[model samples]
Target: MAVLSKQVAVPKSGFSPIPVIDMSDPESKHALVKACEDFGFFKVINHGISAELVSVLEHETVEFFSLPKSEKTLVAGYPFGYGNSKIGRNGDVGWVEYLLMNANLDSGSGPLFPSLLKSPGTFRNALEEYTISVRKMTCDVLEMIIDGLGIKPRNTLSKLVSDQNTDSILRLNHYPPCPLINKKTNCGKNVIGFGEHTDPQIISVLRSNNTSGLQINLTDGSWVSVPPDHSSFFFNVGDSLQVRLIS
Candidate 1:
């Protein structure tokens, strides 16, 4: 969890002025809408997801990643299981590895790597609990957005995600540090972890370790580094939501 400095252009203010919304506050609804309209991104606090649950899930995830590559590859596949470096069917690649799982899977569906890990049960249990908690928080946030917009039927947006058949995904990304290549020639820059991209879902909820390297493109065409807050969740308004707002 060491802090790694990023070699990219930063906001002139030297800080990310991303909007912070407190879920417990009744007046936060309007602010949430404003954040979506302005930056399409914001940080949420006062979310009820417990620190203990987050810690447990993070520990299990790290343990899984620490396993030898051969063992980790047991669950390797595209669109649903473990993936390393390669992103999507395209030739895109990044300096990261990830595990993508279907969030709607039944709790008793069993572990993704039951025979590969010493504590497979623990990993599966942690994943289920974490997904359930995060899904709840996502619904709450969506409801707030609906309220802020004065949309008919408060559940308009929330229902899309809360439904049993919802096509939701949980991605765990690990960006391991790489040695700098030819410092002077490379301008002392680290390889891009994941290239610039927009989420195609209605919304995306993201949380990461204390290390900071994330950046968001602003409406005015400037990019600002997102300050890391491992305890708080960040929400991104995706393409579907943006189109829905206009239509």
Candidate 2:
């Protein structure tokens, strides 16, 4: 586990540089494309997802993570289910654990959790509802982006994700709070949480608790910490989208 000086943490300020887009507004498509071109990341508001649904899933997630380590391990599997510390096979480690699920399990991918989950049925239901809503929002955003780009057939980008065979994934990440360091040095250290990396998919939609550690690299190569907003989802253009656009 690599540690970095606390100085690396940027303090939250009154103003934020991250672009905010209102998804309900048709004119926002222009801003959406501009944000993608400029920052490749932006916050979305009026996304049409229910707050009640979000809360239900979050509550279920908390209960799931609170399970005994032994019980939680029941769902453990490579590339899916429960993962702790180590992320991917690249040997990159972080102070985080996550639950990864295939977005579309209906195409005969089989059940994701074989025998775990204290309330398996309830958990699965929550997952299904949340996934359906978010996936729709993702397609909507994609179509808007395509419209702004003046591309033929706005569904060009949206259809890829909307397909039943789409390999989209839903990941729920949990970052436990790490204890503060020695009072003597006064320069506290922090653990690396999901060490710096970019999403390789078409796009990534993320939401987190009030705790704020998410940061994005700018076009100029400087890192800027994003303020946490539990009510809104954050979207980032992935490498696949960039490749698609360029091609």
Which candidate has the top score in lDDT?
1
Give me candidate 1's TM-score against the actual structure: 0.89
Clash count of each predicted structure = 0, 0
Residue 223, model 1, lDDT: 67
Q: Any idea what lDDT model 1 has? A: 0.80
Per-model TM-score, in order, reads 0.89, 0.87
Reference-based lDDT, each prediction: 0.80, 0.78
**Candidate 2: stretches off by over 4 Å:** 1-16, 107-115, 179-188, 245-247
Angstrom error of the Cα, residue 202, model 1: value is 0.7
Off by over 4 Å in 1: 1-14, 107-111, 180-190
lDDT of 2 by residue, 1-247 (tens): 1111111222454234778999999999999888777667789999999999999889888888887778777878777678898999997888778888789857545345625666777877888899899999999999999999999899998898889888898888887765554557754465678898877778989897778888876443456678989999999888878666555
